[model samples]
Target: MDFHHVSVLLQESVEALNIKPDGIYADGTLGGGGHSYRICERLGNNGKLIGIDQDSNAIAAAAQRLKEYESKVIFVNDNFANIKSILDKVEMNAIDGAIMDLGVSSHQLDEGQRGFSYQHDAPLDMRMDRRNTLTAKSIVNEYSEEEIRKIIFEYGEEKWAKRIANFIVQHRQTAPIETTGELVEIIKRAVPAGARRDGPHPAKRTFQAIRIAVNDELGILETAIRDFVDVLKVGGRLAIITFHSLEDRIVKQTYNSLSSGCECPPQFPICICNKKPIVKLVNRKPRLPSEQELEENPRARSSKLRVLEKL
Candidate 1:
């Protein structure tokens, strides 16, 4: 399948970066090179872009898409969580700006063989990086019921997590749940008919929860955000687009913490804590997709774009 993804908030995110003609920038989630392409357009010959992605497929696809600007682009097949090390390897001291689009690409969800979608009946493997040993199958068949329940409840925020976990445990006892279709069926059985009658597909939440657990998505987010900030120049900006509440919450809280100046109580007359804010929020509230963009790509409806600049 062709590596295709409708880059959410393309204009908004690039604009938020405030690209400099001679500045260095990074696209931390370079899916199909969509945002990177826009960023490159605003850069002069002296400017450079580091495009990073954990998925080799994404790297390959982006390379082809961005071939015209090869001289201005450096592609890295690695997770954005290791931004500090990645910058060191590339001999880049700091970046002028960076953007992270946290949504899974349309290609990943549409490709049945990759197992990223509940609509696809494929092996339960959701590793964004194929090199990872952990797979959704392992989590589904191996994790304790309590562990499964916790992930669904905390990550997915699915209210029927307990029942879903119970159903999975029962189904696996008879035979290992091996495919997305089988898991979907199990979820359908677990959620009450009335509850399943409305809202999202019965399996959506469980699939999201399992994918997150498999990739340790939320676990690495806060640290990665801090790392991105650490590698940013004094006035550099970081723009992140999150597709779900869990990710948005982390980004908001981390940005808030980093942008806060003092921790001393208000009662103190003189300043005791020497703590200072490292960045300032560019937008007090996240930027949502425009109505036109939403009409073109409903998948972007949940996405929220938050930007910050280093102090």
Candidate 2:
């Protein structure tokens, strides 16, 4: 499948950056260069954009899409979690702005062979970066039922996680669950028919849980957000678009932590810890996509764009 991802909240995120004509910027999740293209368009000749993505395919596609601004663009095929080190390597101490859109690309789900979608019957390999050895197959086949249940319950927020884990274990005992189809079937069998009838696809939550586990999606997030904040120049903005509640919660809490001041107790007469706010929330609440944007792309339905400016 072609590397294609419709940028969610494109205009809102770019505008939130408050882009300077000659300022340096970073598109931390430069999928297909959707946001980067707009950023590059607004940049003067002296302006620069550091486009980063863990997926090599995304980097390549983004490169082609932003070819006109090649002189202004620097592509890095690395995870945004490594933002600090990446900036260090590039010898950039600070960036004017940055954006992170945390959502799986359309290509990943559409391309059945990549195994990100339960609707597709393919080998269970959901590694966002192919270089990583860990895949959905290993998690499904090797993880203990308790561990699986915890992931499904906590990460997926699926109420039937226990039964799903039980079914997976039972089926794998006969033969290792090698494909998404097998896992989907196991999930369908595990979830009661009446329960499945009401909500999304029977296997959606379990599949989401397995994919998250395989990539450790939530593990590096908090640190990554802090790292991104650490690299922003004063007055620089960081806009993040989170697709699900889990990601949005982390982003919100991290922003709150970074932008909060003095943790001293209310009864304290004087300040002690000296904790000062590092950033200010650009918007008290996250910005949602407009009705037009949602109509154009339903995948962005859950996206919430939160922005913060460095103090």
Candidate 3:
């Protein structure tokens, strides 16, 4: 299958970055190089772009797409959470802007074999890197019922988390949940008929929860935000596009906490902790995709772009 993904909030995110013709930029989740291509187009000969992705497919497709601008582009196969170390290895002290588009890419879902979508009946393998030891199969079949419930509730925001976890644990005991179809059946059994009909697939949230746990998506996002902000030069920007509320919340909270000047007590007359704001939010609210973009690609519907500029 072709490694294809329509970059979410493409123009909006690049605009949020406020790219400079001669400055350095990084696309930490360079999916199919959609946004990265646009960034490279706006750059001068002196400008540089570092595209990083853990998925080998993304790296290959992006490399081919960006070959014309090869002199100005560098590609790496790694997770965005290692942005700081990546920049250091590339001899970049600080970048002018960075972008992170979090969530499973459209390619991962549409490919069918990657097992990111419950709509697909492939093997239960949702490892983003394909190199990771942990797989959705292990997460679904081996995790304790309580742990499964926690993941579904916290990561997936599924109201039927406990029931779903219980069902999974009960069913998997008969045999290991080895395929997406098997898990989907379990989820269908757990959710009420009316509830399942009203919304998305009954297994959607559970699949999301399992994939996230397998990849440590949320944990990586939390760790990456601080490092990404630290690597930004004064006045540099970090624009993140998140596809789910949990991911959006992390980006929003991280931006807010960094932009907040100090955490000192209200009663304190003089400053003591001396914590300073690192970045200022470009917009108080996240930028959502326009109606036009949504019409063109339904996957862009849940995306929210948040931007922060280094202080």
The lDDT for every candidate, in the order shown, is 0.94, 0.91, 0.91
CA lDDT of 306 in candidate 1?
Answer: 99
lDDT of 1 by residue, 1-311 (tens): 38999999999999999899999999999988999999999999999999999999999999999998999999999999999999999999899999999957888898788888999899999889999999999998999999999999998899999999999999999999999999999999999999999999989988899889888999999999999999999899999999999999999999999999879999999778988999999999999999999999999999999999999
Better candidate by lDDT, 1 or 2: 1
Backbone clash count, each prediction separately: 0, 0, 0
lDDT of 2 by residue, 1-311 (tens): 27878888999999999999999999988888999999999999999999999988889888889999999999998999999889998888899999998868887888789899988899999988999999998888898999999999998999999999998888889999899888888888999999989978988888888788888888989999998888889999999999889989999999999999999999999999899999999999889999999899999899999999999
- The TM-score between candidate 1 and the true structure equals 0.99
The list of candidate 1 runs beyond 4 A from truth reads: none
CA lDDT of 12 in candidate 2?
A: 90
Model 3, 1-311: lDDT tens digits are 47789999889899988889999999999889999999999999999999999999999999998999999998989998998889888988889999988989989899988889888899999999999999988888888999999999999999999999999999987888888988889899999998988988888888888888999999878779999988889999999998998988888888888999868899999889899988888999889989999999998989998899999
- The lDDT of model 2 is 0.91
What are the clashing pairs of model 1? none
Output the worst ten-in-a-row residue range by lDDT, candidate 2.
1-10
- What are the TM-scores, per candidate, against the unseen true structure? 0.99, 0.98, 0.97
lDDT comparing candidate 1 with the true structure? 0.94
